[model samples]
Target: MSPPHAVIAGAGIGGLCSALCLARAGWRVSLYEKAKILEESGAGLQLSPNACAVLRKLGVLERLTPFALAPQAIRIRRARDGATLALMPLNDAEARWGAPYLVVHRADLQRALLDAVAHEGRISLQTDAAVTGFAYGSDGVAVAISRGASRLEATGDCLIGADGLRSFVRQKLSPDDLNFSGRTAWRAVVEADRVPAAMRSEETTLWLGRKAHLVHYPLRQGTIINVVAIVDEDFQPDTDNFWSSHGASKFLEARFSRWDKSARDLLSAAPEWRKWPLADRAPAARLVSGRVALLGDAAHPMLPFLAQGAAQAIEDAGVLAEVLARGQDVEASFRAYQEIRLPRVTRVQKESRRQAVIYHLGGPAAFLRDAAMRALGGETMLARYDWLYRVRESPGQK
Candidate 1:
């Protein structure tokens, strides 16, 4: 008879995309975000063809193109000599996957998704509402949230946790299972005009050295460059829990002092920088618990080496929405969602860890690794990722 109502926690990319997909499937959706104002906070995010396809299906791809860049190639170079170790071409990537690879500001993508959600009549967004507790029973699920001094409650057939790494919903499920990856990532955006003309390029460049790596790409129609430098360190700063904590330029420069000129130049060009301590959790044996389901980073948090953090989250939203639209038993649909997604996300998590080791090889080991990568060539890398980039969930099925 009536469409089921869904309550989504967090308005990040995953949550917003989930809301969009559920609303399109004729489900009434309400999204709660703790932030009073929705603004862009992070640096750049690279969307593979899989993520791009989902956005295209959601009708926001065209709107995002102006603020995004589709690089023709990705080059991995040695930090000492800038010698290319491997090159993956993206010239015909769109022809193969039906969508091109894209890089965009985290804020711009969020804005585009939010705008699309605004047009959906079945979806209502409530900002400044922080979900405090939830209860699942035979009748339904009831969520308690707070905004300032006021408390609000909502009941729905299902509750999805699309919140980020520090998800409140996750705390309820597996409170003591969180694990840290022992790596810290520093990110910043520098204006193209401020960078030296010789340093700017249309390609995505990565410089790998011992225990650290730097990735740089163009964003905002090539007007700004996004740089992410990750280092393996034993300690993290004791400060606020925010991901966008300001970082010191001197500390970063010292970390990369032995790197090549290209990385040095890029690091010097950074106008603003923030630090993010990469963290993850062992795969939850189950993503759904009765009337509640976990989505995005809350369900599966992976390292950024593979650049699939957001991409996987977007995939989760699509698959979950498709299963829920079947009108089958909610528990059965959610169980199917976890079964279909767990294996893939687990593989990604493991691969990302392997890449971290590969990118940080040192001395003779680094040279040997580079030689092996060159022998395999660019086509091999692209071929290796086809399974990840080509996946699509069939609607109305697990």
Candidate 2:
């Protein structure tokens, strides 16, 4: 008998990861991307322990380590005075969580995934191929794809929507309005030489402030520092606006004018910036319908506060691959995939939204938050992620 086949839409972190995971599980995969060329436009992303374990299992982690930085810790500070509130040590994360916490440029990780996908004989990736819609009955699922002026259709046992926030595949499956949280994230990468040694250390530093927060971490093996400042303001997006849209420095300068000198200095050092409106969606009633299922951002678009957007997406890919490779009926496998993923991703989405508010608290609230952090200390705080960091590396694992 021929092996089961899967058709995937989108080629971002989630899509590419899905293809690699499925192929490793002994399934032939047809991955499609709407973009003629694949390029990750964002800055740095955190690869938590859970995500790292999955990547390691898929044989993609080693390719990423050269470009990935294992930060020693995450230092949380008060934006007004730059006072240390807590220090979460990550130096021993691999020992505690079973995998290392890594920070790397988004493009580097994407390239690694693409490289792995290219080498897989069971996987075929096609760019300039957009999945417009899909239909599923008893004869598996057929995807309608658009390629420039031509159209084509492909059949597979299942369809995985790994497209990003504004996914066409998602619109056809579980449609929900994207909530713009009256927040914007301005991101930039400053050369290591341009940043002061204190600001460019081997730790991820976070500054909490009034209606805003700043996070910076070293990337590219310490040659550059990725900085992101998220502020409270709703920048209504238009048709032309992308996730990483061109941003003006003046806006960031004015909003962060009253922050501590260290925060201002880091912002000034960035030669240019790109901003993205923070958007998320409520968990859908069902992530799977028939032979189709959603993965990554398409399934659960969460805020970046918890730094689990990519991690959760990676987790989704792992679980989806595991369930589908079980040799069950195609529709049952997709339903099983949803059953395993929806709850965990929903929790991360809610927690991420809560953290956003806590990071931008004002006057009295900010003080109490800091005091609590200091009292809690670093190790105590780190203990909270135990549930998140310890995950199943394979279908048979505990």
lDDT of 2 by residue, 1-398 (tens): 99989999999999988899999989999999999999887789999999999999888999999999999999998987889999999999888999999999998999899889989999999999999989988768999999999999999998899998898878887667887878889999999898778898899999999999999999998999999999998678663454668889999889989889988999999999988888878877778888888888888898999899889989989988888888888888888887778777888888998998899999898889999999999999999988888857564443
In model 2, pairs of residues that clash are none
Q: Tens-digit lDDT track for model 1 on 1-398?
A: 87899999999889999999999888999899999997766778999998888888899888899888898888888888788888989878788776889888898899899889988999999999988999998768999989889999999999999988888998898784555577888988899888777557877888889999999888877898888999887765443553557778998889888877767888998887888778867767778898899988888888899999899898888888888888887888888888888888888888998898988889899889988889999889778888778746473332
Query: What lDDT does candidate 1 reach at residue 141?
Result: 90
Model 2 misplacement above 4 A: 239-242, 393-398
Q: For candidate 2, what is the TM-score? A: 0.97
- The lDDT, on a scale of 0 to 1, for candidate 1 is 0.85
Best by TM-score: 2
